[model samples]
Target: MIKIFRITAKNKILILGSNGQLGSHLSNDLAKLGEVTSLDRNGFNFENPESLDLIIKRLSPKFIINAAAFTNVDGAEDFEKIAYQVNALTVKKLAILAHENNAVLIHFSTDYVFDGLKEEPYLENDIARPISVYGNSKLEGENYINEICSKYLILRTSGVISKNEDNFISKIINLSNDRDELNIVSDQQSSLNFSGFISQAVLEILTELESNIDKEKRWGIYHLSGQEPGTWYEFAKFTQEISKKINPDSNFSKIDINPIPSTQFIQKAKRPKYSFLSSVKLKEDFGIELPNWKKSIIEVMENNE
Candidate 1:
């Protein structure tokens, strides 16, 4: 059953990491519901934890959506401490603040929390076994949120792609501009989520919360992603195909995609072989079905063009 929830105009909402790919979209969507106070990296520095208390105390927002994180997969390998500080320790502090203020904390988590040993898509209840420093740091953050925050929603997503930022899809598009041939990993498998779609889905949940429709059932982790699972190579090819149709004069039309094994690619951090998330729980609970990856890809490309 699909439920439409109404949000009051005066409710205050604070969004951290407002300049990020997902954060940017979320800020725009969330602004419609209530008063939105957005904070970029400069506004809320994770490195300086002491300053957070003053910001949270002063804002006194009813909801705090944290989209900030140290998301450099390869870079995390070289700087585990910085990753842990930003991803784990800072999340703990935020969780504490949210708890003290009786604010709902909506934190974004990654699919990398899983080890990718399972053939099937991961469920919200699946045991997390992270394989890299980046994954471990994210898992630690999740643990902190679970421990400290009673009113929280941990949304686990995978391969977040956006037209406005540097992600998997944008990287491929940029690379195609300069190179005729592109090599992408075929072994990695996950669902690619669009920032716009994700933000809309989140908006639905927030609306429900405002209406007090599903207040009791909303707190906890949920898997949100595109409908189908696909490999990196397949995603790149689809992007290329769509890009060619959208912009025939673009260099993406001339690019030849080459599939390569994960082992062939060298990187500082290890990625999960299969980390696709199942959005069945999210659909059943929120009554929102995520769009297909192809639809999202096409929409993003069309909007950017």
Candidate 2:
């Protein structure tokens, strides 16, 4: 039987990109464990990599959670250099700093790292064949973290949504409020991740690490995301359905959701057609499972309202 670990106030946690959807949730959830020094883009600029090194050295946090990234998928196609700098170069610097400080680095990655050609859910050791600049940059960041930091947890999640940020669900909600109908892609397939659930899982993993378990076995890349796989059309439809259920009289309740192919929804970035991540490794190691995407959507929608 695996023993659950408890967190103490002595564990100093530093959260980068604290203002983001996932970062915001992490800051709130992780605060219960210890002193959390949350930093948004303004607080710590990735433009200046040196600033990261300086801050990590000064704070000397026991746990450094990097939730920040250049997440503009289509924008990255035009600005690859900026994306690489923010996502890959800065991450490499953070890993180095974390290693020097003897801190456990917790970094967030994406399912986009995969080419999405595989029909089955991707495992942790799957070969990454990123098709877009954003995906490439994220893959590079993962590589740097794995090489530089001996004690690190790289969580590769998919389609992260939350009430606080402009994610897929929020976009659908906003669009439904204005438009009568929507064209959602039906080709793309992946699990939707809730930032709140991801944050909670991270905390639980931290607790396990804080315990006497062999840190080496636990420290590595793990696929953490929703259990159910779905297409963008289904995700949007469910969002609309749940929104209507939550607010029957709301304008969003009447909007029509139409399913379309990926070719019709042309974008600058080429997203993977199928990039679902399997959380079996995480469950086997930590004995934790993420909540269902449908349940998470309802909770987020209700909470935001």
Candidate 3:
């Protein structure tokens, strides 16, 4: 039996980090379902707990989707405090608030929570051994939410790319425009996903939960990302090839892509060498299918063109 919440067509919803790439897409799709209150940087600062509390109280939303994170991988090494505050502390506070109000909270996480040493894809139940400050902080945040909030969904994904925002795709296009060749990390491996696709899936999950509360099969951490996994170099090469078709007249040099080891890429923080997550659980449990990395990239590029 499906247990439906007492929700009308006008249920108020709040989207934190509504200005981010994923958040932007989520906010747009969620608008189709109900009255969505989108909060961008100007309105929502994750560092301020009291302000966040007040915002949640004022909105009193039935669903709170947090898409914001201190995503600067390298920057997180130097700014661990800020990263923890935004990624871990804010999520903890949000979880508490959600539990208090009996509201469902959906949070986005990353594959960085794993050490990335395994040859096979990571499962949701796999041991998390984050190698960097960013990964550790995010894992802490996920743990806090699981410990504090009874009704929450934590989604852990990897290698996010989008055409509409300040992400890897745009950066590559912009950089390639100026320079003939670009060097992308080749050693690290994971799935690449579009922001729009992620948002759509989130909306589906939320709708399912709201419509069928008794559906015990509709909750928990689901690995949501691209299907086929590839190295960053392969992803970059595909991007360049795709861009050539989109901008034939543009003079871009065919630069040699060097596949270097993780040790070669010097950075403030360490990274998971293999962070690909297995989608078997999500597929088997939720009947959700993640598209292949190449297919997702092509679709996103074509959409932009």
TM-score of each predicted structure versus truth: 0.95, 0.95, 0.92
Clashing pairs in 1: none
Q: Would you list the C-alpha lDDT of every candidate in the order shown?
A: 0.87, 0.87, 0.81
Cα RMSD (angstroms) for every candidate in the order listed:
4.3, 4.5, 4.3
Query: For candidate 3, lDDT tens digit of each residue in 191-217?
Result: 888887888888777777777765545
lDDT of 2: 0.87
RMSD of 1: 4.3
Clash-forming residue pairs, model 2:
none
lDDT by residue (tens digit), candidate 1, 69-151: 99999999999999999999999999999999988999999999999999798999999999999999999999999999888
lDDT score, residue 280, model 2? 93
User: Across residues 80-112, which tens digit of lDDT does each residue of candidate 2 receive?
Assistant: 999999999999999999999899999999999
- The TM-score that candidate 2 achieves is 0.95
Stronger candidate by TM-score (1 vs 3): 1
Candidate 3 clash total?
0
Q: Clashes in each model (backbone N, CA, C under 3 Å)?
A: 0, 0, 0
